[model samples]
Target: MTPHSVTLDLGGRTALVTGAASGIGRACALRLAAAGAKVRAVDRDAEGLAALERAAPDAVETVRLDLTDLAAAEQAAAGVDVLVNNAGLQVVRPLEEFPPDAFRLVLTVMLEAPFRLIRGALPHMYGQEWGRVVNISSVHGLRASAYKAAYVAAKHGLEGLSKVTALEGAAHGVTSNCVSPAYVRTPLVERQIADQARLHGIPEERVVTDVMLTDSAVKRMVEPEEVAEAVAYLCAPQSSVITGSSLPLDGGWTAH
Candidate 1:
């Protein structure tokens, strides 16, 4: 038997990326499109999804969706070879001050939605005998931070769910893995910065330095494209044996 090339060539394949409107999800959609995948780019933001469609008009199909709607998520997953569970939200506040509804909202989107999508996509992938699942977790998934109980707990659960999916999908030729990244320059992170500053009574600059980047040995935020490259790698023909893994693209945030 011969091994396939390390580089991904997704020509003729279809990929569905949640949260494809901006940030890491947008980057992953672009990269997968560049690798020849037919991308179903999904997000709650219609305008953002339209922008993504404009940027890759030929390769992308925009789908407006709220992952919190499990039926809609399942409908979106149909006929896709790759699933990128990237839709997420962040809320930073002291545990005692966290709103109950806000906590549930974050957990629902970040953890429950991904789980539902994976379950919905399983039979399709199993029937096809080839599939890939990429869950975009966070540095908080592997570690902890103050004022981020919901985000951290959801990410942690997502990582665990990915591992279980990997185990179950092994015999069916499907693989599941997570790409955990450090803070990136995205709208979500920017919002977190403002919230953290207000909560801690610190300058926004310090939020980046003392909060997000405090554990990162590299002293820089992870690039969205860098995380996308890892997604491309896992989608390659040769990465069949790479399931049940959480690959950190976190600027060495966990090294300490």
Candidate 2:
């Protein structure tokens, strides 16, 4: 894909970004704030949230939230003009060995929480006739892989939820879409490298080139900032006509 810079003016928007403490979420929170939005950064990491607050005290406010608390997750989204469901977790294990509890937790935080957040934000968005919902899905949402049943399942569910939200919200000027990316340079992917290495019986270095990037034509990991830019673009007026779509930052993984 050709690279292009996005210019946006969100002077009066209030944006809520979950998993805002680090990685893609951090980049997104800062990017939106730079565009003049009042951002509420939510995450379960207190120290990370504090660090994020210090980085942009005037533009960002931090909220420590564990999405497993479904009620609170919904309550936290109230009155926001933008909602980014970017918080998620993963476990690598064969289905037979996978813990049932882990599967439920993954679905709860990644899928159910997003539903509640949308539910909470919808009323306000409908009232104003404008809102943006960006779900951070993964390439796994479209394609399955070994040892990632739960993560893949949750992402697939998120994709469906996003599409449904788009269909229903279009009439109200509230758009919902997903940013599905391949492996990103994040703490989560870093952790996955080791797990993948062990599971595939390869060295950590080989996991990147042989396992992770095996299908990626670019042969490199995507940057968190790149994913954040896509999120920002979806919120731009230029993207008002785009909804119920999945934009893949897969470096040709999906192209194949």
The TM-score that candidate 1 achieves is 0.96
- List lDDT for all candidates, in order: 0.91, 0.95
lDDT of 2 by residue, 92-153 (tens): 99999999999999999999999999999999999999999999999998888899999999
Global local distance difference test of model 2: 0.95
Candidate that would win on lDDT: 2
Backbone clash pairs for candidate 1 read none
Error of 2 at 56 (Å): 0.8
Number of the predicted model whose TM-score against the real structure is largest: 2
Per-candidate TM equals 0.96, 0.98
Worst 10 residues of 1 by lDDT: 1-10
Ten contiguous residues with the weakest lDDT in model 2 = 1-10
lDDT of 1 by residue, 52-166 (tens): 9999999999999888898888878888899999999988889999999999999999999998888878888999899999999988889998899999999999999999999
